[model samples]
Structures are given as structure tokens and as C-alpha cells.
Target: MIDAAWLNPVIAFSIGILLSFKLRKISARVQSRRGPLIWLPDRWHDINRSKVLQPLYDIIKLFSKQTIIPSTATPFFIAGPILALMCAVLATLFVPVAGISFDYSFSLVVLFYLLMGEILFIIMGGISSASLFSAIGGVREIDLMLANEIPFILGTFALAITFDTLSIQQMMGFNILINPFAALAVLLSIIVKLHIKPFDIPEADTEIVNGLTTEYGGKLLGVLETARIIMVFVLIALFVDLFLWIPSSGALAWVIFLAGVIATGVLIGFMNSLFARFRIDQATRWLFKIPLLVSVLAIGWAVLWRYVL
Candidate 1:
């Protein structure tokens, strides 16, 4: 028998692919973390094939293609996306699916560190591609990381303070009710993390020829996409686990959790459709200036809830 947690990425990839059908109405581009997995026109669908599986098919197509590496890229090029996928899979063990997860006392901390490390790995891989465009994309990713990591920490930290624990397994409930601000802050940070519209400067595909992915092709690119689709599921599930309600067992619990995940994922994809990409300076400035304040207020609220109140 295999670990139950292994099913999450598969489920998430399916959901992401289903979501792309809707996302196609918004942006035909595949620049999102999971949105627009494949933008098939109405006429492009095969009558026998379900479009919901298109993302899966896309990955399969890439896996079947030849792998190519740039002459300028270092040995680390192959390692980067693999390492990032490892981070995502590791993080999955900490995030519950229908209240099933393998988490420890400080797993929340570990989860975040892994998510952050995933970015570093991607940056390492992207820059190693040695294309000037890839280099610029890496810089943009670093800048965006600096800007958003703050709110990401603060929002989750606020939750830690309120719950008085760092174990994610011990912190399941409708936490969004207790601190909507923190949840909102985390949600905003996720938009940046996943590179939705406006905050998508890091991989502004139209302007940078697919940004950090500019130099990647074939199986290498497929690995990156696999990591991406998995992370989308992992992060959205993390949000639901932390901020929404999910009982410890039963099929109903799974349904509720899946509903929440789908809703949230769609919300994120909707954001991807709503705004044009932001300039790097504007994006970073907005992230730091705006969500930071909400996160600060969330911390204050957490302090009051945990202590004074």
C-alpha cells in the first residue's frame, strides 16, 4: 500500500486541469502557478477525450519529448527543479487531506521553510540556465520573494501566537473566523507566491519569454510543471487546513475540504484573470506597503486574543 498523502498531488493536478477550463475564459496564457494549465479552444477538444485531463496530458507530452540542456547551464540545472519537487512532496506530508497528514510538533515551521526553499531551488535552476532573460527572471523572483515572505511569515506567525502552538495537526479549525485578517494576509501573500496577475512580474511571460523558464525545454520543463501543480494543491490545502474547518475523518469531511480547496483555487485563478501584470517596483512596493500593514494588524489582534482579551 502507498501513503495516502501521495494522492493529494494527483487530485490537485486534476482540479487544476478542471480549473483551466474556466481559466481559459480569463487568460489564455500558461504563466500561472497552476492556472491555465492548457488553454484549449472550444474546437480543440477531442470528443473522446475529457478536457479535464488536459494538464495531465500536457505533462505526459513533455515527458515524452527529448530533454535539452543549454551549454551554458551548470550541473545544478537538472538538480533545481528536482529539489523543488522534493520540497513540495515533503511539504505535502505536513498538509492534511481529509484530515490525513504526517506532521510533527513543529511541522508548520518546517512546511514554510520547505516552501521557501522551493523558491531558492527554482531560482538556482533558472539562473543556471544562464540565459540573460532567465537571469533577469531570477532577480525578479528574488525581489518578489523578499517582498512577500514578510507577510507570509507574519500571517502564519499570528496564527501560531493565537493558537499557542506550532504543530499544524494541532491547529485545525475555522481559524479564519478567529483571525480573518491573518488569513487574508496569507491569501495575499499566496497570490504573490504563486505569481498571479499584477504580482506576476517574476515570470511575466509576455515580456520575458517565459521568465526564469525561458531556457528550459522537454522533460526539464515538465518537472517544473509537476512541481508547480503539486505546490498549488499543497498550498491551497494548507490555507484550508489553517483557516477553514475540516473534521478529522469521514467522506463528508473530504468533500468539504475538497470544496474549500477548489473554491480557494478558483479564487486565486480569478485574481489571475482580473489584473494586468504589475511593474516590478510597483508589485514589490504594493506587497510590502499594503499586506504588511494587514499582517501587522493581524499580529496585534493575535496578541490581544492570546493575552489581553
Candidate 2:
């Protein structure tokens, strides 16, 4: 039997790959385009046909290429992606899969800081690159962080208060059924964090030429992409563990966990297809409004339910 310490990262990595394909297919279908083909007879077409493996292939291809650092880049430039990836992977340790999780009193706090650290590294990478586009992306990332962080914290606080514990495993009850407003707020905040459509202002490819990653290439870029893929799974799994807990034991629990992951991926892809990109100002204002208000109300409700009514 594999230790959960090792098994969790493998599961997370696999889920990330699956999500990449699911998102691609969903987005393609939404746009009335033929989604990825599963198989092709000819070797020439076979490479392109294995749609599920595209992300993996891309990563491998990136690794095979030569790395190029900008002449103006500081030593910290290389450290950025490495640090971001480390933080992202570390964040996964706190999330539970099928009732298996690391137990700690402040797991939630650790998860929060790990995520923040990942973004901070991205910002550092951008600024250190000494590229105009990277600088803009870094600034936008900071803007989005400021706009979404408070509401995210409030939403998590509501959960912590409702559950009366900071350990993620303890908070794994069907809290979404109880305090859906907090769940909604957290979901919205995650959308921003994941850089999904409309909220993808920081790395608006058209506007900033790939944003914070503009100066990154080759194996370094591959590392960043892999980290991002892992993060997609981490964030979605976190949401499922927090909001969509289903009552089951043993094998059944694993099935429900996977279903939740797929459902979340599809929802994210659908939303990405449905919305247009929001400007930075628009994104900031919108995040501060409904999600923040809902989070505040969720906190009030948690308090009331715990104490008064």
C-alpha cells in the first residue's frame, strides 16, 4: 500500500491532467467547434488526436526546448517559478481526498498562506523579469489579489466559525447544505484565483502576451505549467472537500470525490465559455460587491446559528 503522503500528489497530478482535457472539450463544444478527437489511424494525426494527453505533451515538449533567460533578468527570475511550484504542491498537502487528509490545527491557515505564496512568487517572477508586459501582469495579479483576498478570508472564516475548528478534516461535513452563502462566496473567490474567464485579467493573453510568463520559456515554463495544472486540481478539490462533501465510506467515497471533481471542472469550463473578460477595474469592483456581501452575510448567519437561532 502506498502512503497517502505519496499517493495524494499522484492523484492530484492525474486529476489536473483530466481537468485540462475536460476544460478543452467543454470550451470547444461551447464555441460550436469540434472538440478533440480521441483517436486517429495515421501517425501524423495520432499525435494531435490524443486530446487527453495534450497538456502532458506540451509540458514534455517545453522541457525538451532550450531555456532562454532575458539579459535583464535578475537571479530571482529563476527562483520565481520554482518557488511558485513548491508553494502550489505544498498547498495540496492540506486538502483531503476521499476522507484522507493531513490533520493539523491550522491546516486552513497553512493552505491560505501557501496559495498566497504561490501568487507572490508569480509577482516576483514578473517584476524580476524586467519586461514591460511582465510588470503589467504582476501589477494586475496584485490588484486581483487585493480585490479577492478579503472576501475569501471572510468566507473561510464563516466556515471556521460554523464548524468551530480550523482543521480541514473537521470542516468536511456537508457545510454547503448549511451555509451555502459562504460556499458561494468561496466559489467566486476561487474563480478569481484560478484565473478563469472574465476574472482572467492578470494574464489576458491578448492584452499582455501571456502576462507574468511572458519572459519564461523551455523547461522553466514547463515547470510553471505543471504547477498550474496541479493547482487547478488542488483548488477544485479543496472546494469539493469544503462544500460538496457526500456521506460515504471506503470505495464509495472515492467515487463521489471524483464525480465532484469532474462536475466542478465542467462548471468552470462552462462559465469560462459563457463570460467575456472583465477589465481590471470592472473585475475589482465586481469581486468587491456580491461575493463580499454574501461572505459577510454568511458570517452573520454562522454566528446566529451558533449562538442565537
In terms of lDDT, the best-performing candidate is 2
Candidate 1 lDDT over 1-309, as tens digits, reads 777777766665566556545555345444444433334556656643445566778889999999989898998899999999888777777888778877688988999899999999999999998898989999999999998999999999898998889988788888988999999999999888888788878788888888898888899899898888777777788899889865657888888888888788768867887788899998888988889999999999999988997
lDDT of 2 by residue, 41-105 (tens): 67667345667777888899999999999999998899999999999888878889887877799
Report the number of the highest-TM-score candidate: 2
lDDT of candidate model 2 versus the reference: 0.89
lDDT of 2 at 129: 92
**In lDDT terms, how accurate is model 1?**
0.83
lDDT of each: 0.83, 0.89
RMSD of 2: 1.6
